[model samples]
Target: MSRLATLIDEGNRPVVTAEFPSIDGGGLAAVEKAADELRPFVDAVNATDNPAAHAHASNTSIAIAMSQFGLEPIMQVVCRDKNRIAMQADIIGASLFGIQNIACLTGDDVTAGDEPEARRVFDLDSTQLVKVASGLAEGHYLSGRAIKQPPALFVGAVENPFAPPLDYRVMRALKKAEAGARFLQLQIGYYPERLENFVAGCVEHGVTRTTALIPTVVLTKSAKALSFMDESVPGISIPAEMIARVAGAGDKDAIAEESYQLTLELSRHALSLPGVSGIHLTDFRHDGSLERLVRDLRIGPAFAPDPVASASGTTSV
Candidate 1:
């Protein structure tokens, strides 16, 4: 079986997805470094376009990560970055490079990514993208043309469980399911009860079969990040106390350690839960903090080997 298939077993194990930070041209290198740093614990890498500040997520750098790193890349194909034609081509191209997982997103607005002049093409939204991927998986292209080998991809979609109108969140997951979404990766929710209630609500809504539900952990101490997040990313809440704790830290290194420690706590908490499938690590500022958390946190036998040749690498992120 392929590595991704093995990572996503429906029964007992949980997978870990490491987020590729949007740190400009240096971001891909960071991802490469992280992949090498956390080889054993990271099952896949979630590639997100920093629609607010990144000009690089939609190009060859993504392809380079897929081909060179041997990392199972989750192509976060956001609609805001491409039209129908571009999205379709990207799906096909990623498939050719053995990228078997995709997360369909309508994408944050250009303003969110801080690129107001950037043209936003959310022409299809996420449901349509899922349908497009499903069609491609079934041996037919979106144009209905038969391809030589239809790429078989495991489609994943996002859900914001903490949104005010909870019904809409349920409906969104259902829509993605109808569009052939195999898994749902939820946006980070601050309260654990809120997270639990969100998943329980999904089960009650008759979408329980839509498995492989992954909860993400966002680690950062930057007040600027919190401000940007509050304005741009909906349903994400950062408490004042948390911010103050990070603010009191002496330096970036100290802040990253604090964030890493928090992430480890969150990871352990999530893994102990029954219905939770996995944890997605989203450390925005810290370079190697995610890797350090995975290393310090004890995992079961299912985790892959450590990516760092030895523990000699810096853990300060």
Candidate 2:
């Protein structure tokens, strides 16, 4: 069994979840390769789509592939480009196909995705999406309709900790939780203090348990990519010094090694934080390097907190 399965079975124990990029961005074959690389320690796989992948909703192949690999799947369904009917159908189809975990997202704008010409259908935002999933779990449809059996899915939602007014993010998470979000994943983790603050904010909102996603950057700190990051990905800051550090490495392999090492260091920092239920390893489409990073670090679920340490009441970022 994978560490995730053991974590789940161990009853509320912290877990180490990894996100698997879907073949929709590259191809199914590429996804398979990434999966094979991460299979060693990857507990649960969250399959996401390309910015323009709303049209490929019919391509549920990733879920099937995950099952074939004996990996638990947390399928994400975005609502920006799908109407309620299509959303409902997809939800039911996913449940029928044995997808147990679902992440409801109010997807980004069409312009934000790869498909600019595609019209969006925001008939239901994340809040409504959560309600829909909860309703399905209760053996009912969103329209006051009933079903033969409720789907048994672990509903999840995402939050951006760096977003303005952190309180608003916490409030949104609370709404998701009220709407039946069983797990919460954050998108900001470049700094250890930021992660701790995010978790503390979650706890303050009465969230006793939620999965904290630690974002791992895989690209080398080259000048070209650093320039691209500044121009294209807003709110994504890669310091020049960090880039210079990577660029100053002995060679390309050394650069990759250092980047992965930084990721592992961040992982270790996140593991030390309290209320950090788990770490989500994100490769960000970096040539299957996450596999090597996990193996080298021997990454796994967080062990039980030491009572003696708790008595000392230690705290850090």
Candidate 3:
């Protein structure tokens, strides 16, 4: 089993995950540098698939590069650009290169990207993709053809607790888990109460018994960035008071500090939830705060309070 798979299965301490910055330029040297910076702070980082519907370096290429540089990658495969056949091939291809984790996503609409004219593809939804990946791991394709040797893939999908139809979010997570998603990386949100309710419901409905829940939090230095996500990002909503709290912090440095504190507070609260297994971070503060956040929380492999590997759902609160 992969370290992440073992960690989640053990359910001892908190797991830490982050998104790798999208690369449009720079060679392997650039990928190496990015991996080096994040390698010390996260158990595994996501190699995103055209995040926000904007194209960057291909997820496969970036994931392979990340592995070459000693950073484990959760290669994301989106259904927006590929059919089931292509997506399955990508998963199998990535596995050959030692990619152990796969995150399936129902990507943003084509209109969300820079090139609106690009045709959209949704041959399979996120839940179906999760099952497809699980099939690959089970040594068969959807067609029921057997593979002599199946790749061991740790499959997961995304969930958003803060989005509309709030009560149904837990059910959606349940669906993914039932579809064979081993983990669910939640979408970023500012509301603790909402997250609490979602996690509680997951536990109540028994979703946590089989699927690991990893809530996502963000590190942004300014309230404007928060406001932008609130207004522009789909499936993400932030309370005005939360934005005001950071905006009122005074100078730029003060605002940045306040933002970091906010993230730490959210991370703490998320970890405190009974069913939560870990935290997934989205860093907008390019200013070394990623390391700082991991160090402060003492949860990731490098900064954990204990030298031993932990998946105990216990984090420093």
Candidate 4:
């Protein structure tokens, strides 16, 4: 089993995941640096394939690079560009290459990307993709055809609690869980109180016990970036106080420091919540901040709290 799967299956420990951009050539240097620096602190690295439908290196290639450096990779499979046949083939290919974890996403609309005129093939939504993955794991295809060797994978889905109709978000999560998602990585979270309430709702609906809920921790470097995310990003909600805190910072370095500190505080608060299996860290535009945070968390016991105790004093998976 992969280290992340083991961590989730065995329970007690909280898995730490960091996102790495899928790029090549000179851009790969930063990814390698992050993988090397975060090797000891992070449980797995998530590779994105041009998240906003922009152009970038393939996620599978990035996963290969991560595997080369002895790092576990969680491949993000977006349904925006591929059809069912292609996606199933990629799943088998990933398994053949020893990649076990998959994060299923419906993907942003083509209009949201650089190429608005590009044709999209959303043959399946995220929930349907989870079902496809589950079928693959069970030695069958979505068409009810049987496979000789089924892929052994840990399926994951994404959720956005900050999205409108909060009640619908929890129901969507439950639907994903029923569709065969074993874990859920939530959208960018800046409001801990809102996240806690969402997790509480998940517990109430029995989704927490069945699916591992992992909230995202996005690290912003400046007030400008925070404002942009609030305005441009579709489902993300950055607290007003957080933006004001960044705006009130003394200088660039101070803004970065404040952002990092706030991220750490949010991480700690997320860890304290019930039914939270882990935290996913995504640093936009500034990868060094993530590296610095991971290093600091590993340097001393002060920052590295016990996951078991922090997670509602229970070791249940």
Candidate 5:
């Protein structure tokens, strides 16, 4: 099993995961630099696929690079760019380089990217992709053809508990878990009541028993970032009051400080939840806020190692 899998199974401490900032340049050196920043604070990091419909490094290559650099990567595969065959190939190919974690997502529409003329491919949605990834891990293709040796993949998917049709979010989570998602990285949300109900529903329906629920919290430096997300980001919704709180906090430095505090509060609330197994961080600030937040919460592989079982052969995230 992967280190992340081992930690999730043991349920001893919170598993910390993060997004490896999309690499657009600097070759392998860029990947290394970003990995160094995140590796210490996270158990595993995601190599996102055409995030927000914009393209950069391929998910497979970034994931493979992260693995070589000693940072375990959750290879993110999106349905918006490739056909089912290509997606399977990316997952299988990354596994050849020791990439074990796969996070399936239904990417944003092509219209959301700079190159709006790009073709949009929705060969399969998120849940179907999860089932397909499970098939690959189990030693077969979707055609049911067998593999000589299947790669061990810790499969997972993303969820938006704060989105509309709120009551159905829990059911969606259960569906993903049943489809073989070992974990679910929730979208960044500001509403604690929604998160509370979402976690509770997961436990009630038995989603949390087998799968890890990792909620996402972003680290941003200003209120403009929050406003941008609230107005433009598709799935993320920030209450007007949250934006006002930071905006009304006075000058630039104070606004930034307030933003950090808001994030810290969210992190603490997430950690205190019972069925919650981990946290996913989306970093928007290069300042010391990331380190400070992790240090303050005292949750992550950098803070401590798992004492229950050392099967991971590495420190816990």
Candidate 6:
């Protein structure tokens, strides 16, 4: 089993995950940089494939690069760009290449990206994709054909905690869990109370015991980024105080430092919440920021030789 699968099975320590954009430029250089700078501080590096519909190197390709560099990668599979047949093929190929972690997403609308005229395939939504992936992992094809060798995968799905119709968020999570998602990566941060309430709701609905919750923490470099998230992002909620703090910062370095401090504080708060399986750090154009944060916090081992067997095992901040 992969290390991430073992961690989820043990459910003892929080798994630390970091994300990086698969930009067109830099190619292997970028992957090498992330491996050198972040591999020591993160349990897995999530290679985002054309997030927001922007074009970049394929996530699976980038994941292959990371693997070549001896780093674990959480390959993100977006449903907007491919049909079910292609999606299934990608899953089989990813597992064959030893990319065990997969994060299924319903992808942002094509209008939200640089190429608004691009065609979107949306053959399956995230839930259906999860079911397909689960079936593939169990030695059966989507067509009910038996596979000679099944892929061993750790499946994950994304959730938006602050999305409206609050109760529906937890319901969606339960639905994903029922679809065979072993872990959930939530789009959250900035509002601890909201996250706490989300977790409470999950517990009340009996979702916590079965599904692992890993909330996202974004490290914004400037007030403009926060403003964009607040204004353009549909489900994210950036507090007013955060905007004021960043806007009031006098210079560039100060703004970066302030943002870093805010992320650290928020991350610490997130770690304190109940039923939180891990924290996913989103690096918003902040080079090496995730590494610095992890090193300064002195959290548990970034890459454990083995998953902790019990709650008595070592903890990661």
Total clashes for model 6: 0
Query: Residue 272 of model 2: what lDDT?
Result: 67
lDDT of 4 by residue, 1-317 (tens): 67788888876667778787557566656567757765766788887866888878788878877887888999889999999998888877878888889989998888889898999999999999999998898999888899887778899889998788876888999999999888999999777778888999999999987799988887778889888888887777787888999889889989877877888888778878889887888877465676566555442122456665768666554
Instruction: Write model 3 residue lDDT over 1-317, tens digit each, in one string.
Output: 77899988877679999999999898999999899889888989999999989999999999999999999899999999999999999999999999979999998888877888999999999999999999999999988999778999999999999988999999999999999998999999889999999999999998999999999999998999999999888788899999999999999999999999999999999999999999999988778999898888888988777634243435542
TM-scores, each model vs. reference: 0.81, 0.80, 0.96, 0.89, 0.96, 0.91
Number of backbone collisions per candidate, in order? 10, 0, 7, 0, 2, 0
lDDT of every predicted structure (CA atoms) = 0.69, 0.64, 0.92, 0.82, 0.92, 0.82
Which structure is stronger by TM-score: 3 or 4? 3
Candidate 1 per-residue lDDT over residues 1-317, each given as its tens digit = 33555656634356777666553556657657756654555777777655444576563356447447776677788888778888888888877777778888777677765567877778898989989987888888788888877777888788877767765777777778778887788887665666777777666665557556788887675655655666557567766666566656668767656655666676677666656677787777556566566656544233433335234455644
* Worst ten in a row by lDDT for model 2: 212-221
| Better candidate by TM-score, 3 or 6 | 3
Q: Write the per-residue lDDT of candidate 5 for residues 1-317, one digit (tens) a residue.
A: 78999989988889999998989889999999988888889999999998999989999999999998999999899999999999999998888888999999999899888999998999999999999999998999999999779999999999999998999999999999999999999999999999999999999999998899999999998999999999888888999999999999999999999999999999899888889999999999988777888888887976755555654555665
- Tens digits of per-residue lDDT, candidate 6, 102-213, equal 8899998898898989999999999999999989989987899888789888888898888787768889998999998888988855788888889888888888778889
RMSD of 2: 5.7
Please identify model 1 stretches exceeding 4 Å from their true place. Answer: 23-31, 57-60, 222-228, 231-234, 241-261, 285-288, 300-317
Q: What is the per-residue lDDT of model 2 for residues 118-194, given as tens digits with 9 covering 90 to 100?
A: 87778999878988887888888878789887667677777666656765767777778788877766663455566
Candidate 4: TM-score? 0.89
